[model samples]
Target: MPIPIELSLHRHSRVLEIAYEDGTRFKLPCEYLRVYSPSADVQGHSPDERVLQVGKEQVGIDKIEPIGHYAVCLHFDDEHNTGIYSWEYLYRLGNEYEARWNAYLDELKQAGHVRKTLDA
Candidate 1:
């Protein structure tokens, strides 16, 4: 698995910048991370039990806690601090960002929820 060489949080822009040793970099929005959190509260035990997170367009990370040599725990400003994001998972998230993001948008649209525009 590729390991992250750097992780930078851009609080003002609500983005987490991750650079991997394989020369791949991803600028993940906080909202995306929050909604796609790997926590049980979000992912659930089964695929059908997963929860769809809403109203997280402006969610920001309050803190990032490293978990040994394998993962990091994100503490969201919304008080969500359960997900243990492993290096592999983070890499996957980056790699599949476009498809995943579009899927999320589609799901929201199907649920009849309109996403609010974030204030710049």
Candidate 2:
């Protein structure tokens, strides 16, 4: 797995910037991270138990906390703070961003859920 040498959260843009030791850089969006969180609350313990996160279009990260040398815990403004995003998982998320994001949107559409708007 590529190790992250730097991580920055751009609040205005709502993106997490990560630079890996191998020179791979990714600007992951907060909504993507929140919807794809690796926490049990989101992922659950099994595929059947997984819950689809909805209405987080404008979610933002409040803080990031490193967990040992492996992962970082993201504290979101929506009170979700359990996901420990490892470098490998983060890398995968970045690499497969478009596909995952599109799939998520499709899932939401099929479920009759819409992203939260300011007026919502």
Which candidate has the top score in lDDT?
1
**Clash pairs detected, candidate 1:** none
Model 2 agreement with the true structure over 1-120: per-residue lDDT tens digits: 999999999998889999999999999999999999999999999988879998788899999999999999999999999999999999999999999999998999999997675556
Best by TM-score: 1
Worst 10 residues of 2 by lDDT: 111-120
Q: What is the lDDT of residue 75 in candidate 1?
A: 99
- TM-score for each candidate, following the candidate numbering: 0.98, 0.94
lDDT string, candidate 1, 13-50, tens digits = 99999999989999999999999999999999999989
**Which regions of candidate 2 deviate over 4 angstroms?**
116-120
Could you tell me how far off, in angstroms, the CA of residue 51 lies in candidate 2 after the best superposition? 0.7
| Whole-model Cα lDDT of every candidate shown, in order | 0.95, 0.94
Residue 62, candidate 1: alpha-carbon lDDT: 95
